[model samples]
Target: MNLSAAPAIEVQNLRRSYGDHVVLDDVSLTVPQASVYALLGPNGAGKTTLVSTLATLLHPDSGSARVAGHDVVREADAVRGAIGVTGQLSAVDDLLTGTENLRLMADLLHLPKAEGRRRASELLDRFGLADSADRTAATYSGGMTRKLDLAMTLVGGPSVIFLDEPSTGLDPRSRRELWDIVREIVADGTTILLTTQYLEEADQLADTVGVLDGGRIVAEGTPAELKRRVPGGHVRVGVADAVELDAATRVFPDAVRDDATLSARIPSADDLVSVRDVLGRLEDAGITSASVTVETPDLDEVFLSLTQPAAPSRTASTAKELS
Candidate 1:
């Protein structure tokens, strides 16, 4: 990511409400150019509201947001021109052929007829949809349809894309394929703001993560940094035999011993310094028959620890409010 370049998206004390129900409260974040910023939050946590506000589909009650160097409210048209949005629901029209869909988007953007056909062909080929170009979207599989929807979003060559739960309902393999596409997009210098229910998605794609809860950003940092905030991170040293286990235990007396696996679990912060210290102590004791690994709490744990469970009523009402 280019630290010298101005941020692709910036928000300051952004707030939104529907009557007495506050959906987004004082949400603030920044997404750098050519990077992925993943927003993780539970249902009814205002993730969609925040994204809608930034995309200019909805207005903020207070605070401000700028996307692609344009204020979301005052310069809504310019912001819309510079960004593309892929909502949770597929935007593919079932009756249209894949090629037709791309051409339609091109028409909406007012591209020249010749250029529109050129872009349609390029996108179909780029997204591996050339063979299915004439196939109606109704015939496309879930994964293929998703690829096409994303492809249409790129027809205008948006500098920044908003992917709201892009991988939702996809199988594991399809989800991974989508992740690869996201990486490719970022590599080509397009900034992405991704909101996902899958915590693993954030861990894989995000350069920075912001955890929203109860209409506010509860935490923000890199995946590793957030994981470090949670407890239960430790290092496990595997030994060859019971004799080696005893020797290892002597080196790390505080470490928990597992006789069955002949490993010692040393509670540590799972940082580089701690790993080096563990290895150094083992070398000092001449315990050579050992394998070491560091284990830290995953994003799931970090998310669980930071956010509260949504009430059933709030979940229903929040959906209606956003709609």
Candidate 2:
């Protein structure tokens, strides 16, 4: 990707502290144009602090942040205009209808009366809140409330959006619904900076993921790259018959057989070339597989291993306060 194409967000030597408690330490990061960057850490790992600073909601003590090419501290207003923040808490006004809520946001953005109404209706439809447009937000489901909150954030058409644990407290279906919404939002060429404790969300939505621990980034890379860093990749293969399995067991001296399923789970790297090699070997032996699957290390594994905790008792809230 064009690294020089100007990032939607940029941070360097980012340091924040409260008294003697340091929340962030020389944290440097870049968010590419139109790409989704997931900032992940357990609760109190300073994920919220980093996000708030990037969104121009808070100032960093020593570090620098730029959103849409404007310095966050010196050009806070410019940064606010260039980016939209969907904070950890719902911004939706509970007394207003969905349409009314969006209109309120449009009005806050200084859109014309007619233009605000047009935009409000447009967002109501886009976020699946059209039918509920007239209904009070108090009666809306958690999923609906989140949709409306996100729609309200989009009224000004910001190029960058910061979502800080946007799916918190929702059921699985509601979380999935919000995930689809995020995908749609990014598909429209918007750059997203999402912070969440849910690893699955990051694994599913992020183009690049940065894992933070103890107020600093421990690792930053694509999902596959980060997975490759940990162990536990395997290949589970099903055979056509017991004879084929027996033959294959002999073919590969070190194979673990499952008597119930008539399959062998091979210990191997779960990479493309390795999979192709396994298939090629089966083809050479004139053997066919009833099924096959590749399993690798997931976020839980990666997080536990990477986030070794610089100091076991440090609080993420302390870090947040420093920011």
Candidate 3:
């Protein structure tokens, strides 16, 4: 709902190829300022390739990427200055302390020594690394290293950030911690372009999620919208007695019944009318279910439905083979 038309990132008709392999074809998405956009895909789906091109780390055969109002290709310096990138792997150096790693970034940005030290100290505290600021990165735990790596990326105070699987190797707690950090960043009005193989991560963090399958966005929308597109949502009703269960099943033959739970899982009608109609019949028949709850397909369910089946309309992979 916060998707403003004021675009923070504009990518149009992007195309890229690897040697003779086509990776992205006619891909386009506009990210609103201060929103989180997640790029999700399985292996070889071009999620990495797309983010790399957008980050200006790799060149696209054709198409333009505009980040924070600067061209990624023509104005690479401006683009870099406006954005921060935390790649799939931790970029922390074992020899450096947490504060030193952040200082390295400040030095690269050419901040005044006083400003650099000031920013470093602030980021260390902001990222919850104040206790370990003096410890060598080599001695940091996995979560600590990741926190330090992320802190280093924020040293320059870039307005937009690119996070590619920031939580990939982290434990659940660490991942949750990273998620909290991401939320805090976005809350402060920084737009994010996130690439992750973890569907749950996308579900949890993305305001707008795009599914890249074989190099194209096969599906794109809010998490709930995408899940709603996939079928198989249902409402399960628990019947009070065996006689009521039999009557309910007779009314709806497609319902899956379980005698043990005294419940029947019926296909959802997606409307209150159908529910009221069914209940009216049950009431007339003197039958009742103990309770009912609507269950909808989740992100994992929707991802499998869109990506597992090879759709013929995919232009990216086909163009790659023929390129």
Best by lDDT: 1
Quote the positional error of residue 266 for candidate 1 in Å.
Answer: 3.7
How far in Å is the alpha carbon of 23 misplaced in model 2?
1.3
Q: Write the per-residue lDDT of candidate 2 for residues 1-323, one digit (tens) a residue.
A: 55448998999989887678777877889998889999988887788888888877778999798888889999999989988888584579999999888888888999999999999999888888899999999999988998888888899999999998988888999899888989998999899999888889999999999988777787888887777665565667788788888877776566688868988877663233266677778767877654667767888787777675556676555443323
Relative to the true structure, how large is the alpha-carbon lDDT of every model?
Answer: 0.86, 0.82, 0.82
lDDT of 1 by residue, 1-323 (tens): 55449899999999899998888878889998999999998776787888889999999999999999999999999998988888673578999999999999999999999999999999899888999999999999888888899998999999999998888878888788888888999999999998987789999999999888778777788998888766666789998898889999999887899999999888764343366777888989988758888788898998887776777454433433321
* Greater-lDDT candidate between 1 and 3: 1
TM value for model 1: 0.84
Candidate 3 global lDDT: 0.82
**Stretches of candidate 3 above 4 Å error?**
1-5, 235-292, 309-323
Give all TM-scores, in the order shown. Answer: 0.84, 0.80, 0.80
* Residue 117 in model 2: lDDT: 98
User: Once model 3 is optimally superposed onto the true structure by TM-score, how far is the C-alpha of residue 204 displaced, in angstroms?
Assistant: 1.3
Best-to-worst order by TM-score is 1, 3, 2
